[model samples]
Target: MPAGVRVTLRTDSSSLVCRYQADPAPTLNGPGERARIDVVCDGRRADTVKLETHGGDAGFRCEGLPGRMAAPGH
Candidate 1:
């Protein structure tokens, strides 16, 4: 993911899934830095995903999310 990029998803399911391919050698601003994505659901901070590589393509599942529509907040 890039800076200032936001993706909104609307679904009635109680969980959210993600699959991504990493750039194994992504540029970083400092040594030992890692990319991260913040997950916000229903206007609250839910989780943070660290883009750690595990050989090749990887994925994650966020379960038990509220199954409703609501605006996100800062």
Candidate 2:
């Protein structure tokens, strides 16, 4: 992944799971510093996700998300 890259997904469930495989060589920051990912919901900032910098296959889980609700009318 490069700078200014964005990944988006849509789900109806109130929970989300994100997984990624990364190598430590490409990381400019050290293990002590972690990247912060901004999670956007409906074009608005909903939450901030802090990534684990240890590298390799790892993921994060988010619960209690404000999922989309059915409107009054179809």
Candidate 3:
């Protein structure tokens, strides 16, 4: 299998909320193929989201809201 692509997202202390939407069109083949997605916030590791290349073409909704501080001095 070929190596997947990497996508980077950055956020700040003031701006903690974020949202993303995927295109509602299929552009690949196979049912077992996978698409890897990574989301980072405030220069720290935040969340890693993944989706399977199945169920036909469909749009996706991703959101990142403010949560508990990762560090104490936040």
lDDT (10s digit) by residue, model 1, range 1-74: 36887888877678788877766644467677667777788767787877655666656667777777665452
Most TM-score-accurate candidate = 2
Error of 2 at 39 (Å): 0.6
What's the ranking of the predictions by lDDT, best on top? Answer: 1, 2, 3
Model 3 TM-score (2 dp)? 0.34
Question: Once superposed on the true structure, which residue ranges of model 3 sit more than 4 Å away at CA?
Answer: 1-33, 52-64, 67-74
Give the per-residue lDDT digits (tens) of candidate 3, residues 4-27.
Answer: 655543333433333344455344
Compose the digit string of candidate 2's lDDT tens values, residues 1-74. Answer: 35676886766678777878776433545566556677666666777876654447655666767777533331
Which 10 consecutive positions of candidate 3 have the poorest summed lDDT? Answer: 10-19
Better of 1 and 2 by lDDT: 1
Cand. 2 Cα-lDDT: 0.64
Instruction: Give the TM-score ranking, best first.
Output: 2, 1, 3
Worst 10 residues of 2 by lDDT: 24-33
Better by TM-score, candidate 2 or 1: 2
Clashing pairs in 3: none
- TM-score of every candidate relative to the true structure: 0.61, 0.67, 0.34
